[model samples]
Target: MNSTGRRARILVTVIAGVLLAALATATVLIARRNADPAPGGGADPVAAASPGAGRPGGPGLRVLSNGLLSTVSLADPAGPRTVTEQHCDRAYTAGGTTACLTPAGALSAPRLLVLDEGLRVKRSVSLAGLPNRTRVSPDGRMAGWTLFVGGDSYAGGGFSTRTGILDTRTGEVIGSLEEFAVFRDGKRYRAADINVWGVTFAADSNRFYATVSSGGVRSLAEGDVAARTLRTLADNVECPSLSPDGTRIAFKQAVGADPGKGWRLTVYDLATGRRTESAETRSVDDQAAWLDDRTLAYGLQRGDGTNDVWTVPADGGGEPRVLVQGANSPAVLPAAR
Candidate 1:
């Protein structure tokens, strides 16, 4: 062959090699993308595109997608969440009421919001301290919230919580449960060091349960709203959440009655007066919600301060499982509760 013909063959060979290398690189990239690990442990669901801010939330599992109010389907708890524009440090919904606790700022105090199903704020009450937990009564006629009123950390044993309730139907606010008279040991209980948190209401709205701490001891107190009274039921019970059936209450019991040692998720039978520890075996500093009468769901913080929701059996039988990733303050809606 002549010199010109040899040069043309060399140019074609170099072009073919370049195309082959590009094709191989593209294939490897696609494979790596497909194999990417999920957010926590299980498979991460592909997040749905943001529907923009302030979308209405309906029936499903209500959660905080980051700090915004969001919802995920109960049929698919680990699926993509539908985020909203509303921001809250904690949130809950049931019956027809949706309660949200807004994050506090340097210049502004935290606020509690009662939003409609369309994500519109119906009523808002300015609150003091950091937003901690909130719950709506089964009948949706009442709402309650807990705030870190004093100290910096709960585990440090210097913290105090203020829990309050609202009569949503009458627009009457019980600013703090402290105003209610509580009886201990069959006598009137009044103490300067009383602190209350984690209010969970029964189906009747007038009855509820909470963790009442006074003089360094915490007990589960059953409160009567009309009478403005509280009756101590059990000791070492913190953050009580009533089950749908009214037969059991789930709470985080301080491990060995010591706050520094962590807590065990426990369920108390109202009739039998028996407490059953859950299988989670991890410290859950949260007010658990019932996913029906048999299962309970609560938040567990990752090492980085991010959160993932986990579920365990109420009867203390099954192992713990991750229900939703990057979410907290779970509320199962009308269909279940």
Candidate 2:
């Protein structure tokens, strides 16, 4: 071959090698992108897109404001972002699901909304009375709510409430506790004035705890969702909130005879029937939310007619701390892990 032809062949060989190197580099880059982990762990590209996915469980506090829901980071509460424009009287979030109580209309009944991870309403049910307390089970299978009926008021005492449970998976709703069989002192008691509220479900979806008031006396009672029965555990314990570990419950106990001024925070052990008062002396009438196994969070009304979220030690020892200001009815948004 001539010298010019030999040089042309060498140039073509160099061009082919450069093309191969570029293709190999592009393949490695594509593999690395595909292996990128999601927010929790899997390769679900939509996981990070979900609201409250990357947020911390205990600190990502969402509270109700002017009937709307707002998300505020307890670590930096100065700037709050409103997640939804719709009004929610109260809400509870767990395991990528949120259950909110929204007003349906001026004269119509209220509603219970089961929201998706993106804060969109997936399912809703019409509810009666004003929305007071709402909660979702840890596993996100069941949701419960307490509403003031007839004469109950959220800001004052001397009222009755109707509590209900809903199976999110089956869309089955237990409208009232009146349908459940009640056993007082190991005997079945059927009273017309019986009222129930403040439901806290156990880790197992079959069992739950609530305050059953009959004959003007309130008592802590455990219920079986499958059997529709309740057995009185202890008396004078109202608005019970189960702990994260399912070992104890944080509730409000009347001091003596006056249920209005006597409301105080108390922790009751489920295994052994023992109640301990917390360091807080103020009247905490709201259903407490367990931030973790050791911390209990609740809403405390200020003198200006607004409420703020406060935290106290679940063991009833440490001083109270303000978790978030200008917020009420706190529900912890658990991070996807």
Candidate 3:
């Protein structure tokens, strides 16, 4: 054969091989994409972002599990539509941030995780005891958690609680409320038995309310985040939840005279100093969440060992109504804007 003809045949052979390789690569890519549907297709959109993500108002309810953080539509409330993989024993979401508490692996230390809008962990704080109560401020600037610690005489309510607050933006932690100057009955008192837990933040995020206990007596105290001071408001109150309007506080008040037996859901008006008890006759032991300006929601323990979420009028007029079954630690996730 001539030299030119031989060169042309060689070129054609190489071109054919290149085309076949390209086709094979495309086939493998398609198969791999089909095998992994995480970003699309069979994936849950709410797990990623909801339609409200770009809208002005579409917040939904979120529930926590050992392995999943499930989200349910507020308007629907039937079944969970989306979920993110998490190990939160308890969780609270607000202002586009979700904070959760999960057990530290292979150790007794617990961890509080601050998650972003995509459900990604932004911060992890090592805690000292079993996770009890977790909350975030209305503005989401502050996060707080309670853990069950052992060793105090007044901690006989099963376990003592260690409460801490965090400023997520600044990464600052107020690990102990005991550091604050506590005023009781208009007088400053110092005692070694001071323990604070079940924090509820105000809308401004600078003021908070929590249960302060000493010598086995519990009281509701208002705290100033900036001043770092606490003043007792009333006795026999635990787990205080500030109303949405910030005018009243819904708290668990010791029923009759025995605090250990349980508490009653009561609302105390800050302006009038008036207190009213909810219609729920059962002893509630959990912090209450304000569903609206007039409704307060809390957890009630049942005989089956499971807890249910119930709501009552903030003014203490109507009977308690069950809102969510088999769930506890209620928080009203506001509409996203």
Candidate 4:
């Protein structure tokens, strides 16, 4: 590996550490998904851009190429990659909109960019903290992000997070989900230490699901974007990702309700309230993405900090396989119909 390759690999390593540290053992029931903190934390070395690098909005898998925005055909994920100028710590696309979280830099603060289907920035907002996770609504009207604001790891209960929401249509931005009113068991619930993250919006764009932690309990909370309210639905659900059909949620549940024991990838049936464990039994820590109604995709880090995008049967059958290599964040772009 040359200088750029070495840097990219090292980034892969640091990013893995960032993810692990972001949700290590003995946590505060924190919510958020994945860790793809930029290439160099603050700044990145110049990338060796290749010929034929172009726009990445076609039906494909959009991912970070050592922190550079890149894409690969869903049919041939291991094939040639189309690189873009966008550099982000975390990225996600939904309903023709892309959310890019730039890393907080030494000279420049981190920011969020809302982009159109053409990958053109429609809006950009300055932000604070380490970019942890980001998701756009299915209709592309809403976007949310999570940041590691304080401390390094959750193992010592030393980490904190700030999650925010943005309404692209109205140019409205909620700096933190903490501003919203939370309710549990049909009453207003308030805690001195409340954190919310990993927002997965519903089709209506007005309603969404996210992990809301209060009183050291993480619950899968449903939110009303218009009312700025979140109602607890279930407990011990972190980084909830609502399925495409809206009938199920893919989340990470800590082993034996202990974060130190690591988390197991599980799916919950909304209508039935039954849980199904995914086939990949490793200590998965990132928020999962639904490939369809029956398949799930997420980033998994190796012991050495190398990362890869993996997929498995969401129905709790079959085995897990690497969908893309040398990638941490995986967002599936709708294949051109």
Please give me the total number of clashing residue pairs in predicted model 4.
Answer: 0
Ten-residue segment with the worst summed lDDT in candidate 1? 37-46
Candidates, ranked, lDDT: 1, 4, 2, 3
Worst 10 residues of 4 by lDDT: 31-40
Write candidate 4's Cα lDDT for 1-337 as tens digits. 6899999999999999998986774253322212323322432222443212332444677888788778788878888887776778899988878789987654467889776666666788888888888999888899999988986543335578899899988988989888899999999998888888789999998899998886767889999988989999888888999998999999999888777788899999888889999998997889899878999999998778778999999988999999988886787777654
Give the alpha carbon lDDT tens digit for every residue of 52-157 in model 1: 2122243468888788778787777766667866678999988767888877653456878876554556677878988898999987889999999888555667
After TM-score superposition, the amount by which residue 53's alpha carbon in candidate 2 deviates from its true location, in angstroms, is: 7.6
lDDT of 2 by residue, 59-138 (tens): 57777766667776656654545545546788888766777887645334677877767766667777888788888888
Reference-based TM-score, model 2 = 0.80
Candidate 3: deviation at residue 197, Å? 0.7
Q: Is candidate 1 or candidate 3 better by lDDT?
A: 1
Provide the clash count, candidate 3.
0
- Evaluate residue 22 in candidate 3 and report its C-alpha lDDT on the 0 to 100 scale: 88
lDDT, residue 49, candidate 3 = 53
- Model 1 segments more than 4 A misplaced: 1-59, 335-337
lDDT against true structure, model 2: 0.78
Per-residue error for 266 in candidate 2, Å, reads: 0.6
Better of 3 and 4 by TM-score: 4
lDDT of 3 by residue, 29-51 (tens): 66754432122122322356542
